[model samples]
Target chain A: MSQKKSSEPTPLYFVGIDGGGTKCRAELYDTTGNLLGAGVAGAANIARNGDVARQSILDSVKAAIEHANLPPETLASTLACGGFAGANLPSASNALKQWQHPFHSFYFTSDLHTALYGAHDGANGAVLVIGTGSCAAALKDGELTQFGGHGFLLGDKGSGAWLGKQAVVHTLEAIDAIQPKGQLAEAVCDHYQAHSATALVDKLNQANPGVFGELCPIILELAHHAEPTAQALVKEGCEYLSAIARKAIQQSNGALVLAGGVAHALQPLLDSDVQAKLTSSTHGPEWGAIMLYQHGAFNQGANA
Target chain B: MSQKKSSEPTPLYFVGIDGGGTKCRAELYDTTGNLLGAGVAGAANIARNGDVARQSILDSVKAAIEHANLPPETLASTLACGGFAGANLPSASNALKQWQHPFHSFYFTSDLHTALYGAHDGANGAVLVIGTGSCAAALKDGELTQFGGHGFLLGDKGSGAWLGKQAVVHTLEAIDAIQPKGQLAEAVCDHYQAHSATALVDKLNQANPGVFGELCPIILELAHHAEPTAQALVKEGCEYLSAIARKAIQQSNGALVLAGGVAHALQPLLDSDVQAKLTSSTHGPEWGAIMLYQHGAFNQGANA
Candidate 1:
């Protein structure tokens, strides 16, 4: 068979970036199987930290281009897509416009949008992101229709941060001897390196929420070991996340796709309840970016 | 009228102190109604912060004696009573025993015991302390029973700290645009100098639980203006406190006396729903100490 040359220039490469509160990552690829480059940088969520997020996005994009050995001038000609933290808010959108990155076309959406697309391979479904913060998004026919992300104080529910907070609470209770003796008390003390409840308070008071949220993995480890307090925390988190999924399904009439770091950690908890309603995605946000580019979603003035 | 003179020297003096998580206060009185001295210091809750609490109690006691100009040599003949945090804990008992004051006789009890005695004039009743921490205690025919007081994280349902925490959570929800708009967001933001949800994250991350708990007064102040979020917080606190009261009543079968800074602040919130179940106390721990000394509870260790 003879190879046939297409008449039009191959669709220009498209990049999709998931700019989160803690980190920004960019994936570059063409329509074919060529994986150009991947870039990582500091946080890029304007809703989380304004100017820092914008700088992170710019830095990440530049790094990806350099890593791919692509001409810097050609960066402006490539279609770029990003799902950022504050893009859903007008104030954040205005801040993003101040960035002087050159691109042939660009599309910006909330982080939920890209995660949803990534989870469902551009199809219609729901995706729950549970990490330092938590949020759920439902897509119906390629359009986001419902969401449940706001952070810990509001509706984080089953997020790692939430579990970590619960662990701290339980540990403190044990230290006070207010609640009956439980394994969680010892586990928390061990995790924080505190000899007594008073010391634990000092440690917790000094630590940041992000640092505290990091302790969530220890909670999971304890849960696996059958600690009652740890089990209760995970159970509560799973229930909250499941409720979010149920609400999303009710709103969008779609299946559920779990994403983010905490997603796989909580799979065992979710599987026992919503196994039939869930599926894993074959392609992630990178493919979702290409799909958006092909549909002309990344036009010069599309976002405007 | 001539007074009968006895050869036995009258008891030189008696003192009673209420040392709590937020403050340490002591009252000194001679055999007559003459007030000798009064002293105040910072928090003295050994369970919450051991070294700070111990130092506060010692400082307050020293200040009282210094203010009264009592001869240091005569102090050994004085009778003293103290109600302190963690007095109920055996581990704390040993630590407390290390404190040696220049007094002939000394007695110690949990703050709750003194508060109950103060509120009920040494009679049997229940008193709920809803300060930075929440704990409920009931006295039934001289027997003390307690519940709650797990600290800010584990329990403390109706405490100032608990209400403050709830207010923060609601404010965060409002900032995230997850919950309905309310005055709580404005009040909290105004107090913390935070303009957005992300700013709140930083504030909460860096602030200590005590600092966070201080915001309770703000919430209480706003509730007076009929703000729904503020009102809700107070209402919830009242209900939780009442629930503890109800439990104490069921366990001890006694009248109720509510004490503590939070109880006074949220008094308006405790409407008939709470008042119908329990009676408020006219006095607090200070009076309780005097009554204990007068009744010779101090002379008999078992009675104390």
Candidate 2:
């Protein structure tokens, strides 16, 4: 279905959406720097699962517009910016283009770009994203250099996924006599409510990565409590992330910004080692989108 | 029952026993270096479980004597040496005094001491033990210095137990959406035969430390297959162990020896980084016991 309305300039309102594999969020703002609305929905990483991703994005955007108290027709002249997981894949990007929204302009980029923009306020710098997955990217003179994020199988070091995976390995080793019993094992059992190591095995085989990676917070909680094993795991993850940031800086010699859910959660992990190398972001991805829009670099329907 | 033996010098036999938590083994040797007999029995770590320690020791000695076809009354004098877990505890030495062996002289020491002697033949050196638990110790001028054996709760840095524990944490984190799916998670599931994270929880709770630690071999296997996560865990473990060894060397300024079941298994890990720092033990704990016996240390039964 296609929705259309007369174009009326629309007070230059713009929308920015960050869509990931597990959840999608959108923020809307006007030219005067006033936040119009924000919305959240289920996952929208099409490469992970197409139909779910499409539905999540549509729902998230619609919710934001509705929350702004604007009629669907009012979107006719509004520009939209989207940073979506899997948008780097041509097929996934094509799938996104199929959606028919009543908007005057739309621009799409990889979620990394928006996150970097959000972190750097559209400046030339580097951003390390440590959400469910991990990735590193650097921007210098408007060009981007990227590393890691080959997905869970190949890479994604220092991401929540990486930490979660390490924690589980420790747990299984403890159960199998290849490791020893410790606080991490106790915490895993307590958090998951599983009666034994065998039960955890069953769940691991049946669950998706998203479901498995969710247990990562329990580790963070344990680490905060000074659980040695958990603390060690987090420390190792930070080291990896810091190494990535260092490499990115060496390549681009730019400022650095950290983004993503886990990034904020693990801010303490950045410590002086990472902070000495880079600067923090002034605004997140949504604001980055606004900057792009203001700079006339984003054309709503041009690419589509 | 206490048995009296004739003053026939018991054919001047030397008995060396390695008393571990899992099993106890004793070997009898004559002056010419011929093995008279060998005996094996159950757990004999007196310091760990006091009630059974004495009985376990007696059973092992009886088995060895019986295997040697020695007449109980003809045994005039014998030297018996043993290395047992928890021997560092005073209770372990006290329990040894309760043993009513027909041997004229007996001695006991911590398993670590024997392992060091076995590995380096009483020479000044260091040893890294990564068995059910992990520890590092150095022997110099007949003095011992140790690091990283605060039990499974506090340390055991490079042990197999450490690797196994990391695996479980990763599996749970994957289930919880805190991490992404990768080789480590898959290996954990396969190793445990668990279908999902929920099942892993059950498995972890039902299994004990020994059982959970069994899965450590799987991580080692995965590391060989070039699983990044597994490799990282192993590398981390090795690094920690090496650090402990370095500290030991700094403290004692001695050569290094590697000992224990896990030590042999993790030789590749050690050789990768600290090849020149270590030399594999020419003998295991049994020989160390014999060396202690020859030195007449067993006769004093000194409580240290």
Candidate 3:
């Protein structure tokens, strides 16, 4: 066997991808399960805009390969797994599966699945993601359940986008004199430099959730400073997030992880009991995607 | 003298238009101010989409000419005055002014200006547009002021679009187990027949405010039947509307005319004190446009 080098088994490479409405991320790993490199790209929401997502996925994978110092053609020999926002829908899942992908093998699942898996290191637990969007999920006896992540328009009550929308709405009210010019209102006006309501409207009339999401940090800062309006909004949003956490933990009876950009700031504000159940995530979504691919679940239905 | 009749001054024809987020309406009148015909077209909020509004304005004028059994050439000789929703913005006003219009002369003013003028029959009064979008305007001492009409995303708290968004948000929460599936929730589910949370999201993912606005009727009906969720939302919206009404009345010291598709439905639901100031519009916005033009108010700034 040592004399015949051609008979040796080829090394395996894995690319794990986690794509959401705001960004797409990828990590490269070697056969020993050691992380090689990671990369990030723009929005990859398959259901919202499949074409953009496909391109983002491609770009993210290519960037990951470059980061790993691997040959560009290595993608042809790599196994890829992706967990994407909006892929929870059967149609979106099938649409993803039908792609003429370049990878040796490709697997797809919901972003929540990967997030939850990463939260517990492939164990049964719960996760609440509180970033540009918000949602909760739990894994119980290998079964998964999700709730409260309906995107910016419908739900996402505790999300950054939601907070941003509330900030803008309050600012507009202040401008119109419908509401008092509270601290939060004044801050928003100053932040945007919008001297007039009409100019403010012109600036934000067609703004997307991402633009609004950018205001989340300001909202959090204001809330921390105890601005009345910001405090009220933060309180309302945290209440909903706490409810979600309680529900997830109750369903799974396991430790919960609060994840996402705004999660840390909110973690301390959640219901005390809910906060008690919170645990640090063991790995990231990319690792979770790799684990999901190896577990044989990704080959099944949308839930799987 | 009869042979030289052509030398006499020709009677002027006027066309007045009222354009909003929902529709563009036009009325033709003789020099004697006698109604000739009326026509309606699609959306014409100039600030939102100038090109679309321009086309709508043109089509509405053409339709009115046809309704009057006049030749198309009549438009070239007609003095046109338009009261458009977004015309209050300086940029939108300039854009409208730059249009290569067919009318002998075209004058523009804010929709609220015309609405106020029409409400008081060219006198000083207040008007609250409660249709697809909501805004209240008051005229006092020949000066007009507007508030609470910040379109769907920013304000429009008591608007049809606002009510619809609330209904959907409540429904999503109910679907997510964050809230109990009350009567409004059940009705929403039945209305869309969305058996799953994902299915419901699919149905409403890309919906515009107008689509949500259509749900105003259902919301109103449910509130009337004392459905807890709908009633709460309606009550909240009506409180805002009442506040707007009181503000408008207090500013102008004149009767307030509630105008819009959802106005009638929300009228009785408003606070009784505010309701006391309510009066039917003396005339429609098209007539208001005409009145503004005749009064030489349309030739001035955005408010004019």
Kindly list the per-residue Cα lDDT of model 1 for residues B95-132, writing each as its tens digit.
66656545555567778878888888777777778787
Ranking by TM-score: 3, 1, 2
Alpha-carbon RMSD, each predicted model = 12.0, 17.2, 5.5
A119, model 3: CA deviation in Å? 1.9
State which candidate, 1 or 2, has the greater DockQ: 1
TM-score of 2: 0.49
The DockQ of each candidate is: 0.07, 0.01, 0.44
- Candidate 2 C-alpha lDDT tens digits along B11-34: 477677887655677887776667
Fnat, 2 decimals, each candidate: 0.05, 0.00, 0.51
Q: Which has the greatest lDDT?
A: 3
Query: Please, what are the lDDT tens digits per residue for candidate 3 over residues B1-304?
Result: 0111335344368888999888999999998989998889998988888998989999999999899999999986787787898877777778877787777667778888888898898776788888888989899977888878877777888899899888888888887787999888887778778867888887787766677887888889999999999999999888888877778888898888888788888888889888888788788888888888767676443211
Q: Candidate 1, which CAPRI tier?
A: incorrect
Top TM-score model: 3
Cα error, candidate 2, residue A228 (Å): 2.9
Categorize the docking of model 3: acceptable
